[model samples]
Target: MAANSRFSIAVHVLTMLAKNCDGRVKSDFIAESVNTNPVVIRRLLCSLQEANLVVSQVGASGGTCLARQPKKITLSEIYNAVSHGEIFSPHPKTPNQDCPVGKNIEAILCRLQKEIDKTVEQKLAQYTLQNVIEMVEREKV
Candidate 1:
């Protein structure tokens, strides 16, 4: 399956907003920085806004800004806002029942996937948007 970039893009957008919290940022500028189309950026922004992570305005001077302070937003919130699929998807077809491994593989994988998901959620919760902004600043040497 193709890897999804929604989570990454959402985090990037949030980090940019946190790093430059002076005023609203145009989606065009954000698109240029992300190397993607403005429409894509706008779509992601809409999702963020729905999640209460961002707020947007209209008109010539209108743009987007974070709804809350960077320190108040967690990576877990962004992940849940944009992520659409299982971290580990099951096989498309059912495994053969004759083989013991095949018969039990799905159950094993399902349990493992649940454990991984829990761990990832815990890790993501430990990170805030402020942490990401600080990391980005450190890389600017």
Candidate 2:
């Protein structure tokens, strides 16, 4: 399966907002930075807003901004906001029941998948948006 970029995009959006703490940013500008369309950015923004990770305003001079300080927003929160499905999905079709490995592989993989998901969430929780911004700034030097 193709890897999804929503998580990274959301992080990028939050990082930009954190860097520009003085003001809100428009979706067009964020799309330019992300190399994606403004519509995609807006959709992601909606998910972030629903999760309380961002606050958006509408009007001629309106845009989006972080709902809270960067240090208070964890990567896990962003991940949860944009990721609607599992990181790894099982095969589309069921495995052959007659085959021993195929019969049990799904169950085994599912158990392992759950562990992987938990670990991913835990790791993401350890890094806040501020941590990402620091990494970005350090890389610029």
Candidate 3:
């Protein structure tokens, strides 16, 4: 299965907004930078807006911009805003009870999955959108 990319894309969109800092950015411009369709960027924008991370406008000069400063926006906040489900999905159908490993696998994986999600969230929470912009600035030189 394809991994979910909404979290990363949302970060990119916000970073762009943080760096721009002066005016609203159109989704098409952000889509070009992200190399994705404008629709995808717009969808992510909707989710971020609902989380109060970004705001949008409509009309000729209307576009999108960050709702708050980059330093106040944590990566995990961005992650939670877009990531809807668990990182790992369980089997669609029940494994055969006839097999001992099959019977216990789901329970075992559930425990592991919880730990994994916690670790990931904790790590992501360490950084903010400002951190990302700094990294980009350093590398751009």
Best TM-score among the predictions, by candidate number = 2
Q: RMSD, model 1, all Cα superposed?
A: 2.4
Per-residue lDDT of model 3, residues 1-141, tens digit only: 497888888889999999888999999999999999999999999999999999999899999999999999999899989995487799899999899999999999999999998889999999999999999999999
- Between prediction 1 and prediction 3, the one with superior lDDT is 3
Clashes of 1: 0
lDDT of 1 by residue, 49-87 (tens): 989999999899999999999999999899988885368
**Cα lDDT, all candidates:** 0.90, 0.92, 0.92
Please give each candidate's TM-score: 0.84, 0.86, 0.86
lDDT of 2: 0.92
- lDDT for 43 in candidate 3 is 91
TM-score of candidate 1 on Cα atoms, chains taken together: 0.84
TM-score of 3: 0.86
Error of 1 at 29 (Å): 1.0
- Please list the Cα RMSD from the true structure of every candidate, rounded to 1 decimal place: 2.4, 2.1, 2.1
